[model samples]
Target: MNSASMHPSDTNVGMMLVISAPSGTGKSTLIRRLTTEFNAFTFSVSCTTRAPRPGEVDGREYHFLTREEFLRRREEKYFAEWAEVHGNLYGTPRQTTMDLLALGRDVIFDIDVQGARQIKSNMGQGCYVFVFPPSRDALEKRLTGRGTDSEETIIRRLAAARHEIADSQWFDHWVINDELDSAYQELRAIYLAEKTRPAYRASWQAALSRQWGVS
Candidate 1:
């Protein structure tokens, strides 16, 4: 769709946002808040081979698949980005995310660092945001407090978190999840500011100028 025929708020040139963080960093919670506040944003439902936890619904939480099925899909290149995290496979569907952006809807991905990096490479134009824990102590407390994983799993996750933190330089923006409200505000500001950047808004601005007879 051309910008000339679309309203500023309803343009088809939407953005792809890839948000990455280690487990228990409140990345999911912050993303939930952002999507709720911004009606124009659509959360991309990822495909996973992991069994859903209690209170997790199909399609809403994830598209659960068996290992065999996931492997088959991976071979077919159905995923934009996929990675094994803590023994479970997670992936984002390539076509669906592109379809959303083509229809003027911002797509948000809450994925692992590996998957986020793959998406950035595949799309080459997404906003990469890395969420960090306020402190190592806080990360430990949060992971232990979740009460979902075994001690072994927690140790593995903490190790993974350290590796992910080391890759923070790959991200375009960073938000520290010290307090939920403050962290969310920082995330929201990054998104809003990105949308207003000259490179992103140039087409819309040109369309507006043309409409106003700017010569």
Candidate 2:
């Protein structure tokens, strides 16, 4: 059906896309390319009690908050999902996400397994994708090649990655980042397909109803 033929309200159906992956799976790069190539996609900025990294701006990368403020907001249930990672508290703002969805903007989340689980429990609708490296050896090479972590830290992260990948079985889709271009194409395909699902396009049902004179 031609979306242009439908009324604004009828065609304005939004979606949420959640993506999670192991630390060295290059998940961030895939998400970056998707958001860059799609104008309709909005990356959800999370709230965090951690200090902003150099060159990170407020409300862009994260909504930086004090520890006390983060806790207060948590208590008020302002976050859809909140988790403490590596001693810092991070959360997705509940109202902001809902408002974006109501406006027909597809929101993309770059979160971890813990955050993904919370989001699944709280909001049952959304396409969840998990990215994986081709092999554990590749993941270790990627992590070690970065030269940012100590050997001990790298070992710990590898163990964490195994657990994260195990939990990924529940995700709707999985993209193996063996080749960057191929992996990105698969990821984009998932997003495009999900967008076309009848459940996500309310206008299809409305248009059909009008044609059948069901109202």
Candidate 3:
């Protein structure tokens, strides 16, 4: 009922962050480390039209869906944001995040720049952070070294990455993944600092902070 408190509608003021990086730049690894290290933050799972890769589970790695099902959801306007990448459609459904954050849990998204923009615009509580590698060459080597794509495909990806890398400024913070441990520490610091933002801390009032040993 008060403006200083979380609006009766909006929730999760700890800061919802969008973390992005060029392919093979270790964004996945960083996200894993981040979620594991910070008990309060969680990686938000996405929904996609692509089939699950080996070892990926349904509703975990991604919410795998048929193209028809994906388009049907699109028609219903159920996605917070959606994109077609490499011939497959990927999206983040709004409800899962809404439910989690409504319960006072922080949500972290490993989405691309475009998705990040959409979510930031739609969800005012969210923040965007870009995890960047040192150089184009390093990104190239990292992707190719995995042996997942052909030389031609890698070239195409690198070209695409150039544009994405330029888009980092579109985010609130750009943390370079040049040194893994250092970057992780810095990202963790952002979490700590965001928690102290007056707006965010005020959401803690008494109940939520009590869960984390905060006043």
Candidate 4:
């Protein structure tokens, strides 16, 4: 819980982290835990063509967009990455994240595999983490329990989940969501580890050496 312990890297540069998981795998909940607990992290709100659900707020939950507007921006290269899921289009803007990273804020994206890949290709940076449900049965049950989607939609999501799970092999880290607290701890540890990587902190080390009058 100590911010200093979590972030020992006093570097001016920040990292971009992309978290991808199947719809029912609880990635969103895990992301909330990280953002709430970590002071150095910020969430990148994505644009989506999907209509807001109950209690969802515009810009806060997502930057709501019409299909035409989404496609227009996509064509203009405004999005660093974009993908369509369950007939809805979602995208992360390039300028938003770049500006944040330039300001030394770590940015986290809650996106699908497609968008994650595109972000890596475009930005050439980011750590990808994929969360998996304990089992297919557990995933299905979680989706059903939401009651936000119809049975048909739930079935579609389950089918998509199979492919998403397979894609986890490409991710930098895999966290299984068997339990909320356990999964969150695993994710937090991964973030801390990435932040402390030698490459990430090399410049900071040099600066400290200079301050201490080390040759």
Model number with the top TM-score = 2
Q: Which of 2 and 4 is ahead in TM-score? A: 2
lDDT string, candidate 4, 102-126, tens digits: 7778999888887788998888888
> Compared with the true structure, what per-residue lDDT tens digits does model 1 show for residues 1-215?
45445455634467888899989999999989999999879978889999999999999989999999999998998888988878999888888888887776889888888888888877777899999999888999999998999999999899999999998897999999999999999999999987875445545656667677552
Question: TM-score for every candidate vs. truth?
Answer: 0.80, 0.89, 0.78, 0.79
Q: Which stretches of candidate 2 lie over 4 Å from their true place?
A: 1-3, 6-10, 52-57
Query: The CA-based lDDT of model 4 is what?
Result: 0.86
Q: Give the TM-score of candidate 4.
A: 0.79
The regions of model 1 sitting more than 4 angstroms off are: 1-7, 48-73, 85-89, 198-215
The true-versus-predicted C-alpha distance at residue 67 of model 4, in Å, is: 6.7
Q: Candidate 4: worst 10 consecutive residues by lDDT? A: 1-10
Regions of model 3 farther than 4 Å from truth:
1-14, 50-69, 206-215
Instruction: Tell me the TM-score of model 2.
Output: 0.89
Model 2, global lDDT: 0.89
Q: What are the lDDT figures for the candidates, one per model? A: 0.86, 0.89, 0.79, 0.86
Q: Write the per-residue lDDT of candidate 2 for residues 28-61, one digit (tens) a residue.
A: 9999999999878886788999998999999999
